[model samples]
Every structure is written in C-alpha cells, then in structure tokens.
Target: MMISLSRACVLTAACTVVLTACGGSTGTGGSATPTSSVDVGKASAVTPLDSATIARAEKQGSVLLYTNADAEQMAPVTKAFEAKYSAIDVRVLNMTDPQTFQRYATETATGVRTADVVMATDAVGMLNFVSKGNVLDYSDPNLKNLPDYARLAPGVVAMSEDPVVAVYNTALIPKDKQPKDLKSLAELSKSIKGKVGTTDITNPMSFGSVSNYTAKHGDAGWKNLEVLGQNSGVESGNGNLMQKLAQGQYQAAYFVAGSVRALIEGEEAAKVLNYTYLTDGTPMLPRAVAVTKKASSPDAAKVFVNFLLSAEGQEAACAGGFTPYRDGVECAYGLPAVEAVVGADNMMLGGYLEGIVKNKPEIVTRWKSAYDR
Candidate 1:
C-alpha cells in the first residue's frame, strides 16, 4: 500500500534532479555539507524576522519569492498575495529545481538573498535545512487544521498543489495509446517502446515514484519501468519535458503539476499538449515548499507555507489534479482516485523514492541494457 503522506511520513516539498557531489553521500538520508565558515544557526543578523522585518523588507510593500512554478500560476498567486497585503511587494523568480537549490545555498552562505519565500518540491533541500536546524520553528495558527501529509515538522511546508502528472501531445499519441492503470501502463510499454520520455535518477524525487511503485507490486510494479527505461528520449527535468512536448519534439512526458499546468495554461503551450491523467493512477507529488535559512520574511513565509497545507490548499490541489498530502482533502476536482496503491493503512509516499536512491539503479540499468541486447 502507498504510505499515507499525512500523519507519520516526513514530507518533502521538492525533488531535485541536477545533483552536485556535495559533502554528504547521495540518498534519502544524505544532507548537503556545511561548506560555509560561519555557523548558520548562531549567526545572528539585524533582527528577528517578524512583522517589523516584513514591513521594512516590503519597502512599504515589496517581497520577492523564488519558485520553481511556471509563470502563469505564480503570477496569479503573487497577485492574490499583493491584494491581501497591499504593503507587501511580491516578485517571483522562476528556476528549475537544481538552479533553485544552488542559488539558495549560495545566498545563504553569502548572508544575502532576494528570496523571501523559497517554494519548491525539492525534498533534499528541505530535509537538508530542516535537519541542520537552518529552519525556524515558527508554526502557523491555521496549521493545526491542515491534513497530516502537508506537515513537514514545524518548519518546511508545501504551499501549492503540485502533483507529478502525465502529459501527451494531443496531436501525436492517440487516446487509445494511453494506459488506463498502472498495470496496463506497464503492458502498454511493450507496444510503444521508444515513444516515452522521463527524468532519470539525477532527478531523484519526481521519477522516484517508479521506485515507490516497485516496492508495492514487486516485480509486477517494475514491469512498467522496464518500458520507461527503454525509452529513446529521456530528459533530466520536467520543464524541459513540457517544452519539448509543446514543440512536438516528443509525443508524451510525465510531468509535475506546476510544469504541466503552467505550460498548458500559457498561450505558448495550450495549443499543443494536453495533460492526460493516467487512468493507471494519480502520480506522486512532484512539488513542495521549504523556508530558506536567513530569510528576509520569515513570518510571511510561514504564513504562505501554512496556507498551502491548509484545507484551502489541499482542496485547491485536488481541484487542480495534484493529490493533497494533507488529510480530508477529497479529490473534488472530478479527478481520479490517488488512493494508496500498496496498502490501505499506509499514509506516506516517500519510501519508494528513498529505495531508488538505495537500490533501483542496478535494476534500471540492467533493464535499460536489455533493449540494446
């Protein structure tokens, strides 16, 4: 059974594919080494990050948010925030997961950052900071009402409903070609051998679902991956995947909710690719949020992360196609059931990702070489 993300599992807000050989070993438990000379924890700054800091940082009302979300969705979210706190100036900078992490780590070490809120699904970063005590333990009042999966201790939290979703260029693949279930999808892989594309281990989290699926179904679950591994066109990130799909460079791609929704809604991509929800099952969460160390607007950041995990955020997630990690979030968007596949009692989806970092590569590599044979 897929573990229930709420209650017990340590939730990760973002997944990164572009990895560096940082001090820590790579895996679910590995953390980024402290490369800076100063102790980030005791290193005090000007003052506490409270309303006063927010007011000052606002410059009467200006705040910058660094996000991995596509511009279209973020634009409106930014506008909503500005409308609520007119004194807050919000500027959002978009980057891939890798760029986002590198920039944050650099900025944190340098003692300067443009990001008031660092939003992402990169769990490695979230865990790195949270475990190292880089995060502030401030909790939002509304947080208690949130579902369990959305909780990432008292610190990092995901504020958006970014689910990893499957997408197809409507112009290229026929509807009949799409898999109706995880089992069927694996079977279908044999038919369309070279037409699929996805991220690799470098992506760790997003494609980690493959490993998660394997744990549940054993060899049966991995059958689908045997097909994915054989694909002729594999990419490192979802943004690239969407762009390629938009241009008709590839017929189908698995995606995070942000990239899919961002592109499909933008005038640039809506004309080309359509998100095809796998009748096979809902994809694992492809996105999440984390508070950076030395943030300029810690309270507001706390508020924002809390909002994403609240009932409001989870419902919004269900409506948008991303599964809500928090509890009581019914998939009211007429979306498919993202019910746990492994067992009914389980609540989290992170183990499979960890498993991949630990074991799946050998299997995937052997599986990949089979096509050559």
Candidate 2:
C-alpha cells in the first residue's frame, strides 16, 4: 500500500495523498489467490518445487520472458535450456526496463498474465513489483549460493551484478597505471585534459549508477565528477565512448561497463582496452529477475529462474561478460570475483532504493549544476 502511494506521489508530484483500495495477491503461501496489499518486503523462506510440479511445468509447452538485457547476452541461457527441456519453447521479448514493468503491471491488473519471467535493470521498479504483490516465489536450492543482497525480498532475485567501470587504452595509460579509485580517476582526467571521455549524463545506466557516488560520498564524490567533467569529451553512448578510446582519440573513458565487457570478453580488443573496478567500489546495478503471480507456465518460470541462478547458467553468463552473483563463479575476462572488487560496505543497492531513485530529479539537477560550473 505504501509502495503504491509512494510511486503515485513520485510520478504525479502530488503531496500527502491517501491510497484507497489497491489490490493484489498476498505473500508466497497459497500464492494463486488475490488479496489486499501487505508488507511485501518481509522475507519468506522458500524451498525447491516437487517432482510433480516439474512434470506439470513440462506440460505447459512454452515460457514467455520480458527483459531489458540484450538478446545476444541471454541467447546462450535460452539455448542451453531448450537443449535440456526439449519440449517447452522459450519466447523472449526485449523491452526497456520501464516498458517491461509497465506491460507486466498492465497485464496483471487486467487479469491477463503473459510474462512468466521478467529480467530488468530497473531495480527500484522491480522492487515496486514485489511491494505490489506482483512477484511469485520460487525458492530454488541455488538461492543458498547467492549473496544476501541479491535476494532483497521474498520472490525476487538479482540476475547479475552489472558494475560500472572505467575503460582505458593500454597504449596510452599502461595496465599498471590505471586509476584504482575516484581520486586517482580525477587525477588521471586532469593529466589527460581533453583526452578523457565519458558517457552522456542523460543516459539512465550512467546517471543511475553515478547517482550512487553522489548519494554515498556526498561532496567528495561530486567533487571528483566535477573535476573529471572539465574539458572532457562526452559521447551520447558507451559504445561510442569506448570506440573513441580504443581508436586513440581518448586516453580513458568513464562509466561504460557494458561496452567495456564487449572489449574485454567478446572481442580481440582486450589487448588495446582494459577495464577497472574503482578501488573505493563500483556501483552495481543488479539486473533482477522474478516470476509473475499469475504465470501460465509457473513451473517453467521456476525452472528457468533456478537455471539462471545455477552454476552452469552463471558460468555461461560469465563467458558472455556479465558478472555472476554467486560466490566462486568464475569472473568474466579473468577479473577478480565480485566479492573482491566490491566490499559489503561499498555496495549501493540499498542506497539506491533509499536515496537515489525517489530523489532522482534533484540529483540530476545537482549533477547538471556541478558539471556546468
């Protein structure tokens, strides 16, 4: 109930409005029935589905997935599943994070549930789905392998830890001299002057993660960004930023993790371009996945979600350049595991939900003010 009011207030800019009669299913126990809103954040323990459930899911014939992840990155997982299951077809719909959530919400409200599974980078929006009782719980045995932060609430799990990174051209800045923290990055930017490149501040992935720096460290983090913003080349997207950096047009680029993943893990450019997680800590935008409350193929959703959180699926993800959530899963491009790169104290998952998402407009305004100065 509070979640609905909060979202309404944020979107409509209305103050102190009371919510009347929001509807949805209750928590994990007896999940198929609808009820009024409850404290959805409370954690509910779960167990693996029984053999009968698996048999029923196999009969469901198809599983529909809606996600924000690139189709190429998800293809391997789907292919592996098809090879094993052989009967149930996997249908994927690629949409923006907002589109994915809105479509699920619309379908749920109208009593027509199409998405059995959903994966998206909009952690805050995904949490909203949990708060509204839209998520269904499938407590797989693999949940034991994941870090606590990955399971924010009952029925929700983080699919990947997509950390922000700085990419540099090895020909210009050598591997050993790369910036390890924000302070060093600021110094490197000053040294390079106009040779520093950055993704556009207007991009959600860039702005959202950088907002963590601003929220967590306050003045110091903003000061680092302010220092780096001077005379730096700004590209509208990370791909362009990385391209310019690799071409020797820029010595370094800031906050382009996905593009850096391609350079390091997908292409032969790893020799020319290398990426680093900040010594202080990189902001992780976890791509969260969940089963819908009214999934037509509930068992298939459980099976797929379990596979994604499994060792084999995580290994495939690492091979494709995404950071796996489970401990001991091999890191992409031989980089250090997530635990080594991001300390518990340095993580921004809670900070993002508590501070950044609700006050995004003000943060963007502050960021613009600092950058323009």
Candidate 3:
C-alpha cells in the first residue's frame, strides 16, 4: 500500500543512458570505491492520436489508474477526468511507487493486467517498466502542448516538476537562520540529528537525486549524501514525513516534494512550515504517467493521459498546486514559475538513470548498508 498523507489542503501536488568512471565510489549504496558517471537519453516520442480518441474512450465504461501520488495529489485530476467524461468511471489505486510498480509487474507477469494507467513520481522506474514493455506506447495530440522534457519515450509523459526541496518549521528556524543549500542544511541538521527526516534513497526518485547530485558535483555531492544520511532519520513516505515535520517532530526535512498543497496544510494545522528550492540547483523531479501495455481500457487510458497534458488539465493541476510540465500556465501558491527555477538541461530525468535505476540492486544495497550504519 502507498503511504497516505495525514495532513489536508496540501494540494499540491528520467532518463537515459550513459556511464563513466568518476573520482570516488559514487553509488550511495554499492562499493566504497568511487562510482562511474553516466549520460542519459531523452524520452522517445510516440505518434500523436487523432481527434477520434476521446470518442472511443467513452465506450470503455471505466479506466483503472494505479499511481504513487497520494489521494490528495490525485483528487483534482480524477475529479476533472470524471467531470469531463461524466460517463466513464475512473477507479484509482493509490500506493507507494514501489508498491505500484510491483503490483503492475506481478500482475503483468501473471497475465492478469488489471490497471489501465500507471503514474508516479519515480520517473526512472516508470521508464524502466516502459523498456520492459509493461507500459503501453501512447500518443496524445496534446503532446505538442507540453515542453519536450515532459515526454519520456513514445507512450510515457511527465505530468509535473515537483521539486525536491527543503521543508522547515518556520517557528523553529527563523528566516535568517534557514540554511540556503543542502550543504548548509547538512551542517544545521547535525545539531538537530534525529529531528531531521527524509525519504530513503531506495525510493527511485531519491536515488536518482543522489546519482544526479554526484554526477553534477562529483566528490562534493557524495560527501553531502554521507553527511545527510549521518545526520537525518530515514522515513518511508512524504505524507508521514511531512506530518512529523508539521508536529515539530523534525525541525526540517530535506528533499520532500515541495508541493503547494503541503505548504497549505502546514498553515491549516497552525504549523509554520515553509518550503524552498535549493540555491545551487534543486532536483525538479517529474512525475511520469503512462497507459499500461495490458490496459483493458486503452482508449480511456489515452483520453485520460491526454487530459492530463491538455491546457484545461494543466490549468487544473496548477490550481490544485502542481507544477505543470506545460510552460506559462501560471504557478500555484506564491512559488515562482518552474521555467524560471530550472531549465531542461538541469533535469535529472534523461541523463542520470544509468547509475540510479539501471543498477538498482547494487545501488540500493549500498544505500541500505550506508543508511543502516
């Protein structure tokens, strides 16, 4: 099961293929020796659908969606889809990225193929499934409406760029005292120690962050990961981690998805938590979604995916607190527009997967060893 977020209103809301040797053992979990560097490929493009797609989708009666996004993050999209179709039922399954991936894999392996769509914050994992032929090759005419970075292979698409940012208790850390970057935050976390929380690196998105950080900053990034791991407690899900943060169990959390919804809930609870992107460069992780290869309702799946990438859907996402992959749609909550914060070249999606998702067993094992110690 996916970990459920406890707080409310928080609306809110990779890549490719190269490897090389770096100076130090790099994979956060593998061997102590320096790891190799990697270059990733961009998402492949799928042929766009004709105008008849939606008409066909209405005949399916329903579409089953499996997603890693919590119920709150998905409510608006589901509501919008159902509202627009008004006829087809959209049944959603909310679970952790790992759980969602595993369920689809298990079902596909057994030929059960229950889910029509799969969505998650783990871009690399979704892409891996795509490579394995688990996700369907889908095209939407709306694809032209999105930035090139949003499409991850012919059938896969990125829905939003939710930054992995710092979340601090405003009441505890004054504005002036807030750390400006991950390194500075690491220094501050040493004082708080167990009071700092973050998702485990084994989660593909976090793992990708580590790999991308190392690729970007080399030894410095690896050192930062060690310092971060040494100073913080590991948590399993964003909702639970943020809940603890709101209650002041942790003074701050590094790498929580900085969605507008989360920030709003902090205010609703009378907590003073605030989120900010890192100064150097924050991991603007994209939540990639696609129709499953075994989709029993392929037509409905395509319609839903297109809706997610459409102007109306993108606007709804922004209103609901998600950073849309579409540019110039306006940002939610007082956050700067995503285009102003990061560029396509800076995304972790296309280039860092070689070390993160491709070598998962070794990377995760190494992460567990380092984390456990």
Candidate 4:
C-alpha cells in the first residue's frame, strides 16, 4: 500500500469524487452503509468445489480486485493467476486503505459494478467491512497450512506478514549505535533529536503497529514510544519517510515498513539506508484479503483467493516483494528473515481491530501530546 505523497493526494481526491457520485458517506466514523437491506445472517454463501468452482468461474470470466497494494507489487500474482486460469481476466484497482473501503461501500450500495475481492493492510478497516456483512465468509482450505494469525478475522486472511522495522542511514548512525529494539531506538533518539522520523499514528496501519508494540511491553513500551514521539517528526507514508531518511532530512526512522527497502534508489541512497527488525518485539502487520459478500464474480473470487494461498501463488507474491509466511517459501524479507533477527516470540502479531478502534481517540490524544504536533 506504499504510495508517494502526490499519488496519495490524487487518490484521496478521486475517492471523494467517486463517493459523492455514488451517494456514499465520506465519513470515517463507522462502517459504510451496507449494500443490501437483507439481514446479514441470511446472506447467500458460496461453497467452492474443484472442477465445479473452476467451471463456474470461467463462465464469470473476470475478477475485479480493489486493493491498497501497489499494482507493481501485485503484478506478478495477477499474471500468474491469469496464466493458470486462462479464462478469468484479473483487473486490479489500487487505492489507499480508506479509499478502498469507501469506494467499495459506495459502489456496492448503489448496485454498481464493484470489486469482487478486496485487500489492504488496515486490519481495523477490514474488520469494519466484515462487521457490516460486506465480506464473504469462505474458509479457504489453504488456511490450514498458515499460522493462526493468518486468519485475520472470520472472513479475512493474510496475504503477507509485513514486519514493522527501524531504518537508519548507515553513514549517519554507526553500527555500534544502531538500534536493535524500540527501547534502544528511543535511547538513540536523544542524540539525534528532531532528525528521527516516524509514521503518523493517525493512520490505521501505523496505529496498529505502535499499539501492538505497546501491548506487548505494556507501560514500558508506551514510555519508550512517548520518548520517540517527543523527538521525532511524523510523516504520512513509509515511502515518504524513507525518502526523507535517504535525503539526510532524517537520520533514522522507527516503526517503518520493512518493504521500504525496495523503494530506496541510487547508489548513494542504497549504501546509506539500512533497516532492522525490532528485537524486543517487531510488529508483523498482515496484508489482508477477502471476497466481497455481494461479489459479482463469487466463483472467480474463490478461485483467486485459493490461488493466492497456494505454493505457486506464494512464490508469485514473494516475486512481487511481499513477505510470504508459508513455510519453505524463500523470500529475502519474509517472516523467517524477521524471525531470524527478532525470534518467533518477539514477532508481535498485529490484527487487534477491536481494541485499536475502541481506544483510537484516547490513543491519538496521548500520541499527539507526546509529539506536541
């Protein structure tokens, strides 16, 4: 879901226009209006069968995917799926997390053509969709092979386990002073002061990562984050934060997406930028995927979800630079790589949608006070 600052603004504007045209509320206070007036309990369900599902899906002929993931990152997966299915055409629409939910809600509510499947990093947002009965609940058999955390919610499954990490300019922060954990990062922040940067906690993904870290260590974690907030400048996207770090505007950044390394450019920027998973407890944010309850191509959606969880699909995901959690799937920045540095126990899973949504206001207040911005 990494996007440049300019692209983010454009997407935000585009979403507002679409929502307005579809008569959908632009508010983020709660779930978008449900598409159907019928009780969610009585909603129709689809049970996938091997040949039957494929036969039906081929007839549907297409699956529209609305995702927060950049098209480049999802290109390989889509290509592989199309190659395998041959009959089903895959169309990906990239949007910000909030926009993904908003537009889907709007289009579906209006009975217009909309996404068959949705994927995003915001657990809280995904859960909101599930709560509103906008998500289809289909148990993919592949779930058995994944970790328990991969089952993000009743209807949602993780597409990847992306680690929240600390990235520093190697030339600026010496190896001896390189932070291995959050507490150490806070300790180092004093020396660097305003040169340290972090993600804006107002964003759901950032909030989830920070809150999960705090949950793992309790009061001590909050205290460390407070110190971090006090000393760091807040940025909106990991891409922007990493850009600033590389440009020497910030000496370091904590609670950053590990995938940011791929965005770094040039020999100078490449040589200076280095990232590490937090050892005390690195937050693994799940990139969640789910089929829509009112999906136009339910059969094709099932086929696509199954493919995404298969071995070949995991390989495609890894090729697109997403971290694959399936065992024996080798990705340079996969869960295993994070585990090697932080240990399995210290890899904090982050999909506490209820808790995060419940205390968002108070948490945001405390976070703002600490940063005083």
Candidate 5:
C-alpha cells in the first residue's frame, strides 16, 4: 500500500476531478521507477511491477487513483495501463493520507462527487466511505480467487502489502548497532536523542504508528509517543517525513517500508541507511480500492478492480516494488511471507478514527497539547 504521489499528468483523461491521495510502494512490482530517475545505489533494488500487465493496464481507459505510492514510479505503469485498455484512463492524485482523507470526506459529505476510485492506506478511511454510502458494492467476479482476507469490504479488495518500516541513516549508525525491533527503536530514540525523526504527534503518524502507540505504554501510550517526540528532535508531516530521511536530515524516520527501500538504494542515502521491522507492531498496512456508489461507469470500475486483483495485476504490483494483496503472488524481494492469512483484512481503524470527523476539535486539542509538551 505505497506510492501515491502524482502530477496532474498522473491523472488521465478519464476523470476531470482533482483530489489528494496517498498509498505506498516497495520491493519492485508492477512499477519501474526510482521516482525521478535519480540513481538509487543498489544494482539489485526492489523489482518493478510486471511489465506485461502494466503494459495492459496503461491502456484501460482512464482510471483515477488516490494512493500514497510515488506518482513518478507510477508514470510508466500508468502509461502502460492506458495503452493496454485504450478505452480506459488512469489518474493518480498523490497527496498524503491526511490530506486525501480530508478532501475525500469533505467532498463526499458535500455531495460533490469527485473521485471514482481510491487506493488508500487507511482501510478505515475506506470504511468511512462505505458507511456514508459513498462506496458502491459489487463483488468482483474475481473475488473467488482471493483468500477471504483480501475481500475486506463487500466490494473492496486489497491491492498491496506494505509494511510500515522504520528507516535510519546507516552512515550514522553501524548495522550491528541498528535497532532490530520496536523495543530497540525506543531505546535508540533515547540513545540518539537528537538524531531521531518522528511524525508530528499532534498529527498522528502512519497507521502502523497506531500499533506503535498502543504497544508503547498501554492507555497512556500516546504519552510515550510524546516522549519519543521529544527525543525525535524533528517532526514533519507524514508524507514528507521519508524524503527527509532519505536525505539524511535525520538518522531515522517512521514511514512505509517499500518507499524507504527505494530511497535507501536510489540516492545518496543508500550508503548510510538501513530499515527494520518492530517485533511487536509487525503487520503491514493494506492499500485498497473500490468503485464509487455514484459511479457513472460501474461496469468499467468493476473491470478495473478486477484487473487490480488479477494475478497479472497483483504480480505487476509486486514487481513494481510493492507487495501484492491477492493470494499467492510472492516476491523474491525478501519481504516476509503472508502468514496465517488474516481472516478479514481491515486497515481503517474503526470508531477511533472517527475523530477525523465527529470529534475533530477535541482530537485536535489533545493532539496539539501533546506536541506542545
């Protein structure tokens, strides 16, 4: 569930609507990009998406995408998808998760239907759409092929497996000294107080950060995050957080795993960076997509969703450096295998996330006070 940034060009002729969106990408799959052609340091970097299916996807008329994955990386695939489905179009509005959800919720609430498709990091956000009757329900004929976990919503499905990875400047910390788990990350926060980078506590971090928050110190886990923030010495919006980490501005950043890997090997950060998983908060986020409840082209939308979950599309996504959400599309990129298939994939945090809507004032109040500390 990575790689969502894109230029206006990323939005194909399919839709006139413009909105912000975010998703993630890592370990080469249907994408072939180092985002701007900057020389990533590794020769064996993550695989790009499968060239064949991507070639087909580019031709599928115009499909608007709201994701966190890199738009630059998606450009080739977008071009290819449009080419294959000449009648279709593809557009990726690349905005941060917060901005994406904000705009989507705002527009959808006001009866301003702007997006036809969304590939988002927060399944909870998707639930927002579904609950509001903004999302359409149409079980893809291909749903039978997916394991139950992939079929999260009545109509929605997972597109990728993206770990919320923590990255650091390898040059700053020796590999032997790198934190291997969340416990170590907390310790490292103390050990290198000024070197750590964190998401703005007032803003909340990645979905994975939710797990980190709870696992941190119980009901007062958010309080521990404040401590971590103090040690962080730097706070930025989640979207730009990783780019700064890639630039070595900070020793470590908490962001999606696959995106950081591209930066680790794609630029000057390579020689100095390393990433690891937290032993406790281990599961990755799932980026998902679904048709609009008011879809002008329901059939086309279903076709696109089916394409995304297909073996070809899933594998291409995997090759493009992101994990495929469908069953059995494994990669050689060293990502952990899908263990004990999760029963019903759910990424959108439940009622807790309602703060973004229902209790924004209080949520913002608490968040600001935390950062103010």
Candidate 6:
C-alpha cells in the first residue's frame, strides 16, 4: 500500500520497501552501484555515485520527501529505492503545490526539522524557492546526463515530463467528432458549450499549460483559448475534471493532465474516457525536485535525488504511470508518444517561472474575460 504523510501526521506511517538484504563491503545495499554503467539511451553517460556518499547516506538512514505527486504514483519509485538501499528509509509527504511551499516555509522559519527533499509542479513557486536560497546547491553527477532543460536551476531538476492533454467521454463524443488539436477543441466547444470543461487558470499548473501554448502560437493560440473559454466549464485540478468527464457531466476536458489516466477508477469510467495529446501543441510540465538546505539527512537526500535521475529509477517511475522523458525509456504516455502524435516541435515545455510571474495577472485577466468566469 502507498504511504501518505501530511503536516498533521508527519512520519506516522511508513511503507518501507525491503526487497533484498544489504550486501557489499561498502554497506550500501543492492547489486547496482551508484555509478554502474548501463545503456544511457539518449544520454551520453551515467553519473557515478560516490561510494563515500552512499556510505554517508546509509549512516543518515532516512530521507523525507515532500511532493505534490499523488502517493499512489510515487509508491513504486519509493519502493524501488528502498529495495535498492535497504538501510535508508524513504518517507513521502503528499500535499498540494501551494501547501507544500507554505508548509515548508513555515517549518523553515520555525527552524523545525523539515523535508529533506521537495518536489512540485509549480514553476514560479520553485523559481522563488531557488531564488530565496531555500534549495541546497548540491549538483548531482547525474545532472550532466539529463537534457539542458531538465536542469531547471543550480539544484533543481525535472523529475518527470507530464503532458497536458484533451480527454473526452467516448460515449458522449463520437470518434469522428472528438478533437485532435486545440483548433478542433475550439470548434467542438461550440457544439458542447458549457458541456466542455477545462482547468481553472488560477492553479499554477493550469496557468502554465494555457500560457505555454498561447506564448508559442501568439494570436492564433489565444484565439483557440478564447473559444474554449467561452464554451468550457472549469475545474481546479485534472483529476476532478476527469471524474466529471467520466461521469458524463462534461463531454470533454481540454488541458487535462495525461498522468490522470493512471488514477482513473472503475471499468465503466475507463471504457468511456480516452485522452489525446493535442496536435497543435502538447504542454509538457516538468515536475521539479530539489534538496533543501536545511535537510536533516542531506546525504540520503542526495542519494535519493541521484537515483531518481538514473535509468533504473526512470523505469520504476514509468511502472508507476509517470510519463518518462528520458530517452529509450518508453511508456504509452511518455515524451516519445507525445512527440509521435504532435511532432517534437509541438511539445511546449511549460513552467518558466520568470516569464509566468511577470505576465500572470494579464494572462489570468485575459483568460477570465475569454471564459467569462
């Protein structure tokens, strides 16, 4: 079972993954070395893990991760990490992006033992975090292996590349009528009107997705959104929108997170709901992860962060339903799939905090006016 922690119940539950016994002279468990060479796929080389660092991390024994990722989605990766490093206990605290930031801030202010690591999808918030010197400046060796965009800041890195997509109830919208791109979605909106749904731009992720596309297509992009806004209802999160879509409350939802496909429950809902990456542009939100300067177990946190960027870790994340962005690690919802449908040029990378922060008010106002909400 997935273990979920919150501010109110920190460290109350533990779901440790103990797949094998600790071995090796270094006392770091598992067959794979931190620097073990493997087929890097698109990457040129794998970063070697320092044996001394691993030993230090083992001594630290525990690492606490505060993230916006759903507990269920993170369980497999956490389990895999623990199975490899049996001595290190991994604890995940799940919260909203806002909550994660606020809670960490409060804890930091109070000089309390806070999260060893943090992960969130809000680019602006993360940029602020980095600017405030909240993140540790420990650059992992794996940083060199990832794409340039993956390195968001000195310490922060992209944990996953999740695409925002259009999801529809198949029973309500015929295959012929379903949208293939934002333009089609805009056209379909006229027929569906309020029956069409979209994310609330107030949310950072939602704003990032909409703004990213609009930034790329200029007037044409805004035109598409203007049409969508006039016709669509709004939800705060993709999961809620998906639930409504599956229930037939909304015939379709645009800019829904493709990752929500894993959270869909019930056979009936699964049969009715289907998603597609918009052909015009698919906004890829790279969830960022960073270690904190105040981490109680800094060494362990470094180990965990390095593992996340490793090939084995990417594979484990894929198993947990995240869209892996690393080369050669294929998932139906991965970067390659989106690229295949929309073309590489159309994959819009969202969450540039600096730009978003500057233009958010105007964007939100324009979005509200377009949607009349």
Instruction: Report the C-alpha lDDT of model 4 over 90-135, residue by residue, as the tens digit.
Output: 9999888899999988998898999999998876777778999989
Q: Write the per-residue lDDT of candidate 3 for residues 43-155, one digit (tens) a residue.
A: 22333456577678888779999977666667888888799888778898887777887888888788885789887776566767777888777666776655577776768
For model 2, how many clashes? 1
Considering TM-score, where higher is better, how would the candidates rank from best to worst? 6, 4, 3, 2, 5, 1
lDDT of 1 by residue, 249-326 (tens): 666665334234433433323334445434343445435565556777765665455545555554554443344445
Q: How many clashes in each structure? A: 34, 1, 26, 0, 78, 0
TM-score of 2: 0.75
Greater TM-score among 1 and 3 belongs to 3
TM-score on alpha carbons, each prediction? 0.66, 0.75, 0.80, 0.84, 0.68, 0.86
lDDT of 3 at 208: 57
- Candidate 6, residue 159: CA error in Å? 1.1
For each candidate, the alpha-carbon lDDT, in order, equals 0.48, 0.64, 0.63, 0.73, 0.52, 0.73
Badly placed stretches (over 4 Å) of model 2 are 1-48, 105-113, 131-133, 137-141, 265-267, 332-352
Best model number under TM-score: 6
What is the total number of backbone clashes in candidate 5?
78
- Error (Å) of candidate 4 at residue 1 is 4.5
Clashing pairs in 4: none
Give a tens-digit lDDT track for model 2, residues 1-373. 0001111222222112222221121111211111113221222233345777668878997899997665666677788777767877889887766677788878877988579998876556776777888788766676775567777567888767777777666667766677767778888787788898876656667676677777778888888888987757877666566656756788887776542454342233544556666657567776678888889898898888877777666667765556665545554422233334555566565423564447777877876775673
For candidate 5, the 10 contiguous residues with the lowest summed lDDT are: 13-22
- TM for candidate 6 is 0.86
What does the lDDT read for residue 292 in candidate 4?
92
lDDT of 2: 0.64
